[model samples]
Target: MSKRRIYWTLQIIGWSVLIMFEYVPYVLEYGFDWDNFYNALINIVLGIILTHTYRLVIRKWNWSSLPLPSLGFRVVVSALVLGLIMALINQPLDRHTLEQNLLDQPLVFWGYVLSWWKSLLAWMLSYTVYHYLEQTRLADYEKIMLTMSMREAEAKVLRSQLNPHFTFNALNSIRALVYEDPAKAQIGITQLSNILRNSLLADRRKTVDLQEELRTVEDYLELEKVRYEDRLQYKILADPHTVYWQVPPMMLQTLVENGIKHGVAKEMGGGFVELSSEIVDDVLLIIIRNSGRLTSTESTSSESGGVGLKNTAERLSVLYGKGASFRIFQEDEKTVRSEVRVPTMSENPVISAKEIRSF
Candidate 1:
């Protein structure tokens, strides 16, 4: 038997035996003495053995076995076991006590039979309760595993949808530059192509190194610079430790694109977009700030000419859920900032390596 089964069986049988012993003395006082003390001890041991056998039988035969037939078998087995136990103990019990009870009448024989049935009832009840608890425990474990599986599937779907959407926006920037400056447009196309290929490769992954994401962002900014000329400038500052941290693949690129599209691009004269990464409170903190305001109106409708930001938020929500936080708000009259915080996976070498891997 498993340790759990053995331990529970002993615990149940031990308590039941104690209760029987306590009551047997009182019954003896009522002249119902069929070796009361000896009989009670034997019944406790025999009942436990019978319960163990029943457990084995149920596991092997299956619980769907016909109820009437099973119960009949149980009752017959229990009676035989109890009678044999009582007979063996009778010799060790006081012969005087048995003689006294039997000399009076045959009523003592009926008492023995009743006691045997009572013992079986106690054993069956305890066994049933233990088995029911085991089943409940197993069911709860399966439920937890199922919930995790569903969440993982949802995360993967959101990641897949967001990646292509991000690439499409980057291509739009290159397209805008083509008519005005074919030379710059050629360079932009090259950068955009490289970014697209990397993104497509990373899509096969659940997450990538932070350094890889930063390189992709740099490529995107270069393409944007061609469109806005000197009017668009950007800076990247990353902590060495955090640069090697892992994040959802292509996540940082999407967020950086949003800062450029909604925040920097919104300025008629164009403006600088600054990206920074640091470790705070044992978490990796990323900030994307640009020279545009995030008014309440902009926050309400992401698709209201701000598909980039909307798409980024959706991806973040799906990947991290409540485990991470994403917030966009106006930093000042001329600046809007998107801040994201995700748990640091400091101990995982593979994850750490991915985070730092460059383009």
Candidate 2:
């Protein structure tokens, strides 16, 4: 039911019950009469009006936001006032109908006021407690939603940074081929276009299939090969079982680009970059091996490395928290290995052996 409907239902039911309790005893002591019935009806109407008015005052002043001590004081004072008003109304009625001189004895009148005060106090406290819990629940829900929105914004900003960085490097590669080999430059442009299209689509989604991401990486490698030619040799060895897994967009390509930029491009002799993936312990593990040596700075500071590496780490952190991990280290004197481990989205049938394909 709506809150307003519920409030009205409870108010009427509560006042009717309290009035019936008083009316029953009077009927037993005297007898059933219309005057007593009318008197009981008037008390019920007065109770509802007084309490409803108190509700309006509480809401108008926003008593819910008050400190506990201040709120308690207000509740106690308001309940006493309501009780005194009720007792004063009942005093004359009791004298006329039931022939009880309650006003003549100060103790009896005050006792009636105290009894109503206790009842009103209980009702007010119950109402306050219910609203307090509801406010706490709503606040917690809003906090969670705000945190999710911030994470999404941060992820978008990170993806935006990756696009420009990747595009700049791809364009530079194509530029080197334009004058030297126009035909190859044309091919490079086509590959770059395809990669850009996939990236744009990827930005609209949180994750893309592993196979699709690898295809973009392949196109990028082809474009880079147009410039480097014999200077760049690479291999992609992926397990068939892991091809359909989901991964962050452009994540693999960024890592591969990092390998060539920091590894092969700097070497006097053409260096090789190797990409591989497999499922290990229900986790998707991707490994990239490039022919290069990591300096002290790169080896020691994974989070503070090149923009690509740092951004990749942060994106992983944002998406997976502690469930995903990335690390790059020197495997040998001439090779640097970068490894990324991400949790799988679903349970898959175990493959006894890995299927590795070379490109």
Candidate 3:
């Protein structure tokens, strides 16, 4: 239910309870007379009006933001004023019964006001706690939404960065091949078209199928293979069961592209670039091994080197938190390996606006 509806419902129920307290006793003794009925009406009005006015004040001032000592002091002052106002309004409506006690108006007013101290304290305590919790819950919800939006925005920017860098490298490779082997360059152009099309279709998604990603990587490797001729050799090996697994879009391509640029292309005789995936105990294990000596030059190299790898790693961390890992290390003097372990999802995870509302 909406906050306004809930607030009004509580108001109605609270005032009804106050009316019942006075009306029930009067009906038991006087047998349902109009004088008692009217007196009860006055009491109900007194409770609802005074308390609701106080609610307006609380909302206007945003009392929940006040320090504890200040809020407590205000609550006490409000309750005392509310009690005095209620007593003055209620006294005239039932002065006949009240006068038999020989009480002056001042003493009578004090008695009614003091009588409300406990009830006011209870009401204010309940209201303050409820308001504070509601505000906290709303604040937490907004914070979570902001964080999710920021992560999504960051992911989009990283994915966008990958495309241009990958495109530039692919075109550069294809440019070299066009003069050396025009026939192979034609084939590379076709592959590059297919790769670009697939990336565009899946660009907005957080994840894509491993099979589709592998095809994009193959297209990239094909372009590189044309330039290197017999020097560059590569293979994509995966279990059939693992092919349909959901993974970050363009992730495998970025890794494979990095391996080709930094590893095989730099060597005298181009080396093999291998893409492999296997699932062990529900965990998807992806390994990319490429031929190169590990030079710690990844950071100061191309923007795609430091930025791309770091972007991929950060994306993995964002998607899987501590549940996923990415690492690069030298396997031998002639090979460098990148390993990724992430929880396997049968299909891409989808989140909707409605689902995000509560968070």
Candidate 4:
């Protein structure tokens, strides 16, 4: 039910119980007294209206934001005032007694205030618990929305970086082919078009299935192969069971571009590019191998230091923290390897994005 409806329902039930408790004793003691019933009805109605009005005032001033000690003092003062009002409202019922004057019997007057004070304090405690729980839930919901927005924004920046790097290299190859081979250049344009369309889709999503990322990478590699011709040979190996796991879009494509730019394309013989994916111990492991010698200045050089590797590292850290890792090093003099490992998680993953506000 809505909060407004719940508030009114509890209000009615609470006041109804208070009214019954007051009037039932009078009915049992003196067979049917309209005077006693009238006082009980009026007292209950005034108590409900006054307490609800006080509640509205507390909400208007946002008293819940106050420090614990200040809030407790305010609640006690309000309850004491409400209890005094209830004692005054029920005063006419005591006119026939020996201690008829509150001025003469001050102890009796304090006894009524003390009884009502306990009842009002209980109501205050109930309201405090409900208000605190509601504040906690609102805080959690805002946190989730903030995290989703940040991840979407970071993904966009990473894709933007990768797209230009891939396109510049592809267009460069196409420019050279135009004078040497017109027919192949035309085909390269078509492959580039197809790859860009897939990239546009990837740019719009935070994550896509592993199969979709692999397909986009294959399209990219196909465009590269048109330029490398007889020198570039590639192999892709993937476990069928790992196809549906979610991965950052275009991640593999960026890695493949990085490998070719630094490794295979620079080699004289232009050896094979090997890409593989496997699931081991609840981790999705991707290995990209290419033929090139590892050099000391590879990462430090401004010209060859493409944004792909750096973006990959940032994205992995943002998305999975300790659960993901990206590393690139030379396996041997003839072969350099880039390896990535991310937790093999299912769909509808709940990630705690609180610590990753840097992105």
Q: Which segments of model 1 are wrong by more than 4 Å?
A: 1-129, 175-190, 304-321, 345-359
Candidate 2, which ten residues in sequence have the lowest lDDT sum?
350-359
Which pairs of residues collide in candidate 3?
none
Could you tell me every candidate's TM-score relative to the true structure? 0.64, 0.82, 0.86, 0.85
Give candidate 3's total backbone clashes: 0
Runs of candidate 3 with Cα error greater than 4 angstroms are 1-3, 93-108, 176-183, 201-203, 299-304, 344-359
lDDT of 1 by residue, 124-238 (tens): 5565555545555555555655655675676566566666666676777788777888898888888888888777776577567889889888998887776687889999999
Model 2 scores a C-alpha lDDT of 0.82
Query: lDDT for model 3, on a 0 to 1 scale?
Result: 0.79
lDDT of 3 by residue, 1-359 (tens): 86678777887788789679867987898798887788777777777777778777887888877888998999999998887776666655475755743365556658778877667767877888788777776676667778777877877877777777778878877897677778977988999898788777656898888898888888888887766879999989998898988888888888888887788889997789998999988889999999996676655354656666787788887677677889888998899999988786422234445532110
Error of 2 at 150 (Å): 1.8
Report lDDT per candidate: 0.68, 0.82, 0.79, 0.77
For all candidates, the clash counts are 3, 0, 0, 0
Which candidate achieves the best lDDT against the true structure?
A: 2
In candidate 4 the C-alpha lDDT for residue 309 amounts to 77
Off by over 4 Å in 4: 93-101, 293-306, 320-322, 342-359
Error of 1 at 244 (Å): 1.8
